[model samples]
Target: MTDAAAGARTTAPILLGVVPFGLVAGVTAVEAGMSPVQAVAMSVVVFAGASQLAAIELVGDTAPVAVIVATALVINLRFVMYSASIAPYLRRLGAPARWVSAYVLTDQAYAVSLAEFRETAPGERSRLWYYLGSALSLWVTWQVATAVGAVAGAAVPAGLSLEFAVPLTFLALLVPAVEDRHTAAVAAVSGVVGVGAAVLPFDLGIVTAGAVGVAVGVALDLRTGAFPVTGDGEPMGDGGRERETDDAAGERGGERR
Candidate 1:
């Protein structure tokens, strides 16, 4: 198949996975006593699973609105990091594109896009397009699933363990994406810290664990100089292996090869 076809084929399963999870979130939100409209709106506007789940958890308990909003905000604080990381690429995009991109900026979109950017050649714009295609596929699926769930929320029986669906979905998505040792370490540490802090009130454990993981990653990057910087603001190179080229033949002969 052609590359575009291949990209579409590969992006299909990931988008499929987003559906059931989004449905579960929508169902749980309504089951938690949120109006169907409210639940659907949250999925449409917020779109962050963790934050939505946190808010739903609080809303279920009849917590104060302030508490629910605060917890949701805290759970979603990680998006700031995601935004910063992707800003360089999006800076050239016009205001309309920027707004749309920000609206669709979920964890999966950011992760998949960044991975594509790193793996593809700098000269190719198709990588970015592929990422956007995959993300938009997932985004559309989520909105549809959420709407379905909101309408069918009452039909989903109680005590069905649907709450675990979200985390399990995240696990399936993230486990395959840990391609490097540093990323693996960050995931492990973050998981441990997040679980350890689970007892903290108002979902503070998530924030704490996230902060620790970010610090660990940043420190590792600095120590290894994984991303090299030059005076001219170019990535000189570091950490990853250097390509070997034959001087006379002007051909490649990599140690890796």
Candidate 2:
């Protein structure tokens, strides 16, 4: 299958979480007295589910718009890291294409695209297509599901309690990522910290939890003398190798003298 097609196919199953999540966002937007147009517009514009839900909840509470905007931005600050992580794959795109890709970026998009990119060759065009395929599929699915919920209004079942799907979906992605002991430690600590910090206001707990997890992972990797690899798949900071090369050159010079 083509890279784009493969990305779409891989992303299909993950949308199980996204489906109900979008439905809830749409239903909540309408419940907050948003017109169906405004609701879907928020989806198209924001595209981040956690921030969208949080903003809608604030809207229902009649919170000031400034507070709503601040909350959304704070919640999405993690995207700075996500963008950095994926920059290598999408850097070859034109500015306009990068902007579009940024708008469509989501947790699921990042997860699925990263998985696909790992398998694909280092071709910029193929990588971009795969990322777009997965992200756009999510975009389309979310918009349609949200529109249905907004128009249907109370017609969508309350019994489904679709909120549960959100966590389950994240858990699905989390499992594959925790492939090693270091990662497992990070995940365990982060999960505990996140749950403990859930009492924090404005959903700062997620940010705090993420920070702690990253710190743990970084510490473990450093202790093991591991570092990030560069684009050429070379270890970024192997001072030992450089020093060894220098020593060999010096020994050769001494022998010649």
Candidate 3:
């Protein structure tokens, strides 16, 4: 099967959770007095469900614009980590493609792609198609589900409590990543911090917990000479196939001249 097809197939099962999360986002938007158009726009534009929901919460609280912005930023800070992790496979694209990729860089996309990246060491062309396929699958689902939720609004029913899908979905992605003591330590630290700081204003606790978790991971890495993935994502060693390809191209140029 084509790489894109593989990516789409890999992402298919996750949509069960995504559907409800998107629906909740849409319903939450309308319940907060957003126009269907505005809610849809945000889904298409921001495309980050956690940030969108957090922003909605702040808006409902009549919080200041600064707090809302800060909350969104805090929630999305994970993307910095995501970008750094995936840059090796994706950095070869042109500026425009990079821009498009950035927009579609959801947690689901990043998690799944990184796992695939480590295993396949797929070439750049394959990586692009695969990532786009996985990311677009999610992008389409979020938009449609949100639109439906916006239109359905209160009719979505309170008993479903669709909000639970968000955490459960994240847990699904996270479980595979914690394969060792270091990762387990990081998860433990982040969990404790997140629960303890749950009452913090503007959802700063989320970032706070993440930051602590990352720091602990880093310290452990540095101390144990685990400086990098230790195997997975060995960005230099794995994706360096592209670097080798580049050198080969330059040598061919020299011989041709």
- Candidate 2 shows a clash count of 0
Candidate 2: misplaced stretches above 4 Å? 231-257
Which lDDT tens digits does candidate 3 get at residues 198-247? 99976778878878988898899788865434333335445455656777
What lDDT does each candidate get?
0.71, 0.84, 0.86
Query: Which pairs, if any, clash in model 3?
Result: none
Best by lDDT: 3
Model 2: residue 224 alpha-carbon error in angstroms = 2.4
Q: Using lDDT, rank the candidates from best to worst.
A: 3, 2, 1
Per-residue alpha-carbon lDDT of model 1 for 16-68, expressed as tens digits? 56777777888888889988899988888888777887788888999999988
Task: Sort all candidates by TM-score, best to worst.
Answer: 2, 3, 1
- lDDT string for model 2 (195-251, tens) is 999999889998889888878878987899776545444223343345457768999
TM-score for each candidate, following the candidate numbering: 0.79, 0.86, 0.86
